[model samples]
Target: MSTTIPGPVLQEADWHRLLLLRATRPDVVARAYAERRRPGRLLSERGTMFLLAADHPARGALTVGGDALAMSDRRSLLARIVAALEHPDVDGVLGTPDVVEELLLLGALDGKVVIGSMNRGGLDGATWTMDDRFTAYDAAQLAACRLDGGKMLLRMDDRDPATATTIESCAQAVSELAQQGLMAMVEPLPYQRREDGSLVLCKNTRDLARAVTVASGLGTTSAYTWLKLPACDEPEVVFGATTLPCVVLGGVPGPDPEQDLRSWGRSLTHPAVRGLVVGRALLYPADGDVKASVDAAARVLRAVQPSARV
Candidate 1:
């Protein structure tokens, strides 16, 4: 099943009203968070999901391929997100506090699995980029807001001491979320600093394996920790490092959508992988048809795991 994107369901005036509401009565947003209905489970009968990820912009990493500021326009970005959420196959969203709260007030999150992004302190390209701090929602905040879980980015760079602080923070977050009976979705990236001082993810399977192992051992317990991972070479080997439930994250979509879908399909066949947590690829496809892109992805997922309940 896939959802269709409606044409201009919201207008400029709607956006203005949303902003005005935030400015005039922030308490309404608080009430919305407290009272909004939530989904019964993160996954339906499918046991898998297709969550739209919008947390990248929070870390100041907004460029999509050659476009330097593809996600800088808030109004446009939110519109695209709303379109994706309307799709039946798209289960929910993962975003920072501000974005998620806006969606909350808009009534776009009802019955959806809303995952709050837990950290955004590691701004892109900064000298201290690896020192990812918990500057956003914490476990208590998420629980108060009635969110299902929190997602944290834990990039481990063996050469960078900042990695130590990030590891500790993530461990604390995992333990706290477990105490709340919430899912702790952690993305463990194998990081390396280039000569130009930019942090890049190392896609080597061996490196990802090490990251998976480290992330798995975090916190007091692993019962509630789920790994949001990249689909790398020899995925079975990379995912074999842990037993936690895994979701393959989408990076920028390549020129060939079919090829990308094939890659995601192959990865989903792995026993550990539960679903897709995609962003730009589905939200901003090359053809600019949000519904088509989302439908294609849904088709890929359905084809790969035809036995899935959803």
Candidate 2:
């Protein structure tokens, strides 16, 4: 008599066979299941992705909403982030775990491109300015949460040995993320300790070139790596650095938002620039209109490329 396996066991065997098939036929499997299995929800079909930077608090940028420590007001920041997320033009957001956790808790992260800020120990007011420690979300945490990727601030002060450690740690982080198939955005700045003992972040042409080289060469895999750069005073100098994709950082809000947008627009058109990662300029605008600011930034991103900007 022909013996038959139990129905459940037979089904399990079939499932294993299918998994093996998929493993061998990666292209077909990816087309069929990768999208569905993707961790975070992807941005809509809009060409450009606008990442709202709200990680100032982690760097001691607590002043907002007219309160010096307004960023500490999680409620207000959460509301603002939710409102930004609701905007049709806003693509994604950039923030530390504190803010990302808030977004996740509020259920606002669904279908959104969530980027975790990896390092924030180099507080703006810290005495040990060059000693930037990876005190935020890490690759393992990001993978555990099924998060999309991570971003780290790597400010190198040649004068300070602490920067060497930061460089090594960042390199390991990049390799770890790559091994896990996660993306990592590295913002490298050549910095120096000033005469007054304060850290002076550099944006000069030579400095930017060094920063780009260091960032691009980090980690074992550069496929998923990206550069977060400043809108250099001299666009030509900054844009000439590396072929790696770049995202212009929206620094502290200035007196002229329009000019700021114009500069950002110029950078967006640069060959190396991939997109924009702005914070105070768009989030804490002088007019306090997040939607309008986001819309304006989106326009710049859209104008640069006909394809989906993100």
Candidate 3:
């Protein structure tokens, strides 16, 4: 089962309208949020959420596979997203304020689950990448916009003192968002610096599991918390660390798409996993077909476990 997603085809004139609105009627963003149609429930009847992730560019990590500037083009990115949203199986989207507002103004997000990306100050390849500051939507802003939830990234590196501050901020965000009856998504990954000082995600299963456990216990309460985790080898080794609902995130794409799809399949079947929140591997596939990659992932979610996670 695959979907044929059309190539990006947003008109320059259509996009100019968005640009014009941003300059002249900037206040209309408030009205768009007020008038947008929201979903009746967060989860589908099958008990799953298949959301597209468009929050990467805000973090200065715009590379997609070998293309370092792939996401730098906003028009192409928006067009791909709009096409993907045309698929009924796509639940909603998780993005920063600018991307979300563009969709709202373009009428691309209706009856969708919109989750605002909370922290993105940790630019790619930055020396202080471990700090992960809250530079985007705050809890109050999410509530004001009527967004369904807020998502934050937590990268823990024992060597970096900045990690401690990030943990505190994420904990605060979780407590505040939960208090408003909104969902709080936390992506906790273990990090380590190479001999050359380049930061790399620690793929060790035990370290990954430890990261998950640590994030699971964050904030004053975990009532409305969900985790965005990577689907790695021995899914149990990482996912078994927490009972919180988890969504497998699609990071960079591998040379073989089949291998990536299989990895996702393994994680989607886990008892702890709720659904998928994929990005690049789907949006900017090596083949440039966003629909096929997203559809393949959606099928995995359907074929795996469709039982309740919330």
Q: Judged by TM-score, which candidate is best?
A: 3
TM-score winner between candidates 1 and 2:
1
lDDT (tens digit, per residue) of candidate 3 on 221-252: 99999999888897887998888989999877
lDDT (10s digit) by residue, model 2, range 25-128: 53543233223233243334643456778777888867643457656655556656676777766667778865775455445666667778888888886876
Please give the distance, in angstroms, between residue 63's alpha carbon in candidate 3 and its true position after superposition: 1.0
Q: Relative to the true structure, how large is the alpha-carbon lDDT of every model? A: 0.86, 0.72, 0.88
TM-score of each: 0.94, 0.81, 0.95
Scanning candidate 1 in windows of ten residues, the lowest lDDT window is 1-10
The predicted structure with the larger lDDT, 1 or 3, is 3
lDDT for predicted candidate 1 compared with the true structure: 0.86
Q: For residue 143, what is the lDDT in candidate 2?
A: 77
Most lDDT-accurate candidate: 3
Instruction: Give stretches of model 3 more than 4 Å off.
Output: 1-6, 307-310
Cα lDDT for residue 145, candidate 3:
93
